[model samples]
Target: MSRDWTSTLVRARSAQDGGDLALAARLLADAGGDPTAPDDALRLLSGVLRAQGRHAEALPLLETLTRRRPTSAVAEHNLAAALGDCGRAGDSEQAAERALTKGGAAPETWLVLGRARTSQGKLAQAEDAFRQALAQRPDFLPAYRDLAQLLWMQDGDLTRMTQAVAPLAALAGVREDAALLYATILRDTAGDGAALQSLAAWVERGSVEAALAAAAAASGLDPRLALQHAQRAQAQAPHDQRARLAVLTALIAAGRAELATAGLEDHLRRDPGDQHARALLLTAWRLVDDPRALTTEDYARLVRTYRLAEDDAADRGAWLARTAAALRRLHPFRSHPFQQSIQHGAQSMIDPRAAGDPDIDRLFEALRAPIDAYIADVRPGGLAPTAGGWSMSGAWSVKLKAGGLHTDHVHPRAWVSSAAYIETPPTVEAGGHEGWLRFGAARIGAAFALPAQHWVRPEPGTLVLFPSYLWHGTEPFSGSGERLTVAFDLQPA
Candidate 1:
């Protein structure tokens, strides 16, 4: 490389290292536009854009690079990731397929394909892709993590996930990722206690301690300890956003709203539209009764993005029938007002701890075992109460509507809570009806900060379990038919 090009690369690297993504982007752009700049410079620039969450801006550059170097698997993979981030799933899948064709089944390529399929709601296909990636490279940590997560979502089996990645925990190079993933899986599966122990062990590794600390902070644990660990990480890489976000969120959860406010303001001053900062700010405001309200357009936009529905009458009828059947099986008591309210679209059931049908008890036991195991393994000593003996106590319903939407809310007394989709309406609008489930918000309390608010689009076999107190609500259905979901809750035994 020429001296000027070398200098440009060095400057860009420094800016990126310092977490000055804007500066890095500007410098990279200047160098990239230079006809004499090396290909490496362009590649590095694309990576910086992606890390900074500017996938849209990075797409054309990555695309052009891939075109110029048709055999460049890295560029193609990057392009695929950018495309997926931009919500162009078909294009992303095609790009991944092309990369795999050229690279001959590389783990990275498979990982990209798996993620793309996941975003497209092709979970089965995505699982296969992830498995394919792992088959190619058994030690591929990312694929393992992703696959484990997918499995956890589907079956709520934390032990299986831990066993799947156990080989990684002892490998020095991959140990940190393994520890983090293991801790996360444990935290989510078993409870918070196991997660905390795993996290502590991960921190002891000395590499990426800051990242782990940040994760700890984000999980709403002791920020001071997390910050101390994060400081170690920042020493090596000053601008790690994951670390920063973790610390910032920890501070907010720790009730240091002033520090969080100042930190967020400073962050926004540098990048006014930082979504992470914006999310933190929203969370901080939740602590105080700040009446800064969201407009109708804001709610509408959120609803449209997350809701699911169908257009055909046949689809609607099918959905209702499936949902009704699930409800009847779950709740057979006719005299009960909650169960009697079963209609075409909505119905509720009551399963009390003290007294409930044997069938209902068995059904809840089946659901609780896997979930409890997962919570025990993942969350460990976290606040998740062991409700294995607890019967399904609270009553909830399946609400279906052609375009019905539910505003965000959290369950109050229920311990383990869930929503199982009996039927999904066909795709409609620009996409299919989203009417999916979304959970996580700081306003729900410190316990929810770690999950970082995730959206799961419901499918026929989709069943999501979370802490009842976690603030969650459904997006509206927009297709021509009703969406069907069965909601239930568990109480202390």
Candidate 2:
């Protein structure tokens, strides 16, 4: 009996190390058929499930184990992680605190607490938690990467971001994320040349993670090399979604949309529930100029709702004027950061309180009806292309002053993208078709001409929705007044 139990444990460990998660889970779950054993097979199974992003499924198991061993810090830590994944941030924070007090000191415990704090918008607390993780394990690459990412995302400060990750770059067993962050920051702040050089140097190391990062970075700087690296990553990790998506995205960027279309179709055949792939396919079809991609029916569903106000011109003008003033006061950027390099003028960062204003909140509420209608009309069969059903993913407002314009771009992570005009300058309405939203433009660096197939004039209170993959931007206009609009991206719920 002792030998049998040992055999099961060894086999389970071997399977997990070999990346056979299903086999490892089965072996662990069946170990002695008793979760109360010292080995704790149930906890192991829950960990495996959580790693696979099955947090909801793993929660009950974690909860059961935590109840059985209430003082076990390991159980509490895992529970906190699962709760965080489920968006129960408050509960996760409490559990994390309990784990820290009960469990022996562990860097991962601190990391989880940091993540919980970050989710709650407690930036300073999160930073301190991550620092505690680093203090516990100096060479903890994940903690360094997280710290760097948080710093960068907060203020877009390259110096502070670099300082956060500099120690880990030269550390042994360094992960790909650190290198990727460094390279991305260089590309954004310095130039593509510097970024590509950094990526190439890492690729020379020949690690799979390095190849994956290089593939992503090369997509913009060198598409041919990106495709090669992506193919290598795919071959190295056949089951990895990162490699597969890189291949698909590289194909599209390289102007091989036909290949991208075929690749996505094959991928969907294998994993039909891959929302990201489904979303990419929409872009692929559009890139290939497939008529079925965004049809007249799709356009009909685009502007489904307009904000209701008194029909009187004075009332509408007053509202637009007030909103524009509010937006100007909230503009967050002087020049667009590299992440949003397409903007020729000031563009705001993702505001944590964007929809908090009563007016803004009401606008979002008003827009929901059309969003639901659009989703219903598009997914008539009730089959969502992605994993989640349908929901708004992110939203931010942009205020473009005179000479301000948006360069053509696609929202890769969004299933649907939208723009709701709040204010438009007189120059936009008076003529040269300036400051109008145009769609169907080819993605940058594509080896083909794809001009704007359609455009819509901005009107206060009117909202426009389109597939996220479609390339769109606003024409530059010469005007002293600012053009204010709120934009958002949506994913499956």
Candidate 3:
């Protein structure tokens, strides 16, 4: 390269490193037409633009760069990412596939392809791609994390997911991501105790100590330890939001609601737009029944998003009747092992605290009535019932046998949602009968408390309601029989 070009490149690189993305783009543009001039420069500029969330601008530049250098895997990958960010999953997958083809299926290429496929909801295909990436390059940390997530989504054993990522945990630049993934795996598999232990260790020893500590506390793990780590992290990096959130979360989780409320108010005073802090604050106030401090708008939004309805009865009942009748006709419900799996998935065989005595069908019917009534009460004219109070709609049922469990997750689109228990085993394992409902902290602007709040020890006859966006899940059953439940969602209508 010419001295002038080299000099211009250095200045552009400097500007990018300095975070002056616009300046870097302008400088790169001025470097002007060597045959390579600007394509190389534009590629770098594209990356900077992407980092700045200007994905539209980045896509064309990266696409042109990849077209010019058809074998450039990095260019292709960046283009695919830009496209995916813009919601063009099909285009992203095509670009990712081309990159993988040209690059001979390297792990990075496969990683991109897997991500693209995942965005398109080709989960099985995505899992295969991720597994293939790992098979080709076992040390590829990204693939491990990606595959673990896919497995988790499939509701595979949490321990297996953790084991999958364990090998990559020590890899450079992967420690934090791996730790977070591992923490999630532990949370789902071993319950809060294990998750709390892992989170505490990460807070004490990891590079993302503050974030880990905050996340741990938010998840209802060792608040004192998390708070200690948060204090240390803040002492070292006073301006870090991660540290502040961690401290705030620890306070919340520890049930120090008053302090958490005060601390959040002070923090928000300094940073008015802190949405996370605000959300925590709302949750804290709600917990304490301090209605005056709550954000009416946020609560309204949450209710409007996750409430369920009674009119849903006809549709849900019809589907249930059809499914049950079909199962009865198919005789799968009579088969020992397949029936076992269904019963296990439905959690019908276990009895948790406050376990209500209701037949699965009866409970479902009862639950539907209230939901339908609520929908009629709130739904605007001309809309339909969706899964989670969104415009979309869906419903499903399951039968869980002994030892069955559901992992944590949120209903993405539905406004109102619920699960109605139908069957409970006559007996349960010691400590197994505590099947309880849990909800995560609302994502809002202020800090309320730490340990993203959870409600435990739910009764079987009792129906609990909350926002759709709130992350929630079920506890494992230790009973010897089957547990049955029908879970449903309602869209915006």
**Against the unseen true structure, what C-alpha lDDT does each candidate score?**
0.59, 0.70, 0.56
* Runs off by more than 4 Å, candidate 3: 1-14, 22-37, 121-124, 135-137, 159-163, 169-177, 188-190, 199-211, 214-229, 232-239, 283-292, 295-493
Candidate 1 structure quality by residue, lDDT tens digits, 121-225: 577898899989988987787887777666655445557756766665555235565666556555445654566665664555566752553455334455555
Q: Estimate each model's TM-score.
A: 0.47, 0.64, 0.55
Candidate 1 lands at a TM-score of 0.47
Residue 151 in candidate 3, Cα distance off native in Å: 1.6
Show the colliding residue pairs in model 2: 275-386, 388-492, 388-493, 389-492, 389-493, 390-492, 390-493
lDDT of 2 by residue, 1-493 (tens): 3335566767877888899998887776654345444445666677788776667777878877778888899888888988877666678889889999895478898888887776566779989999999999987766876676566556667677777766765652365666776666666655566666776666777667777867766666677888899888888888887888888878887778898888788888987655556656766788777875866566555434445454588866776667666666555345554466345555544342342455555666677777776676665225554544566656667877778788777775566788888888888777677888887665443343466767888888788887765667888888577778888877666
What is the clash count of model 2? 7
Indicate which candidate wins on TM-score.
2
Ranking by lDDT: 2, 1, 3
Error of 3 at 219 (Å): 4.2
Q: Is candidate 1 or candidate 3 better by TM-score?
A: 3
In candidate 3, residue 147 scores what lDDT?
78
Better of 2 and 3 by TM-score: 2
Question: Where does candidate 2 stray beyond 4 Å?
Answer: 1-129, 153-155, 172-177, 184-191, 231-261, 271-305, 308-361, 376-414, 421-436, 444-449, 473-493
Per-residue alpha-carbon lDDT of model 3 for 188-275, expressed as tens digits? 4455466555555556564555255345534454556556666677776788876777778667666676777877778778865454
